[model samples]
Target: MSTFIAAFLFLLVFFLLMSIGYLIKRKAVQGSCGGLGVLGIEKACDCDEPCDRRKAKDAKEKARQERLAQHRII
Candidate 1:
């Protein structure tokens, strides 16, 4: 019984820490990598093509450039 209790406590703590890490990751990080790089497997997407985040960022940048061009007075 004591051993089971100890194991349960350890697992509980582990899961709690994992949950906190996931929350922090979701709130604090941006962008996704498609390769097995240093960040970790969790940060990597399994897609064969570009990820959605990069596509969105590229689209945003393009829109900003268009707006700037429109505002330019030359």
Candidate 2:
């Protein structure tokens, strides 16, 4: 019947669009923080371990402080 054909066409188009979306997501680069970094906010890692970016920032800050302390003796 015509009703059955229309329903089948609608479902087919819906599934095709879903498949395209899935493919796009799979090819895209995944962000660590759900795009919070783009908004200038620090994104926490979802892993059990500390984030590498956080560790690197901490290390950089510690180095800068040490340098400042060394210069203060002059």
Q: How close to the true structure is residue 60 of candidate 1, measured as C-alpha lDDT?
A: 99
Angstrom error of the Cα, residue 10, model 2: value is 0.2
TM-score to true structure, per model: 0.37, 0.35
Q: Report how far residue 27 has shifted in candidate 1, in Å.
A: 8.6
Tens-place lDDT per residue, model 2, 13-60, is: 998887898776644445676676676656455445667887898789
Estimate the Cα RMSD of every predicted model relative to the unseen true structure: 11.3, 15.8
Model 1 ranges off by over 4 Å: 27-74
- RMSD (Cα, Å) of model 2: 15.8
Give one clash count per candidate, in the order shown. Answer: 0, 0
How does residue 34 of candidate 2 score in lDDT? 61
| Candidate 2 least-lDDT 10 residues | 40-49
What is the C-alpha local distance difference test score of candidate 2? 0.77
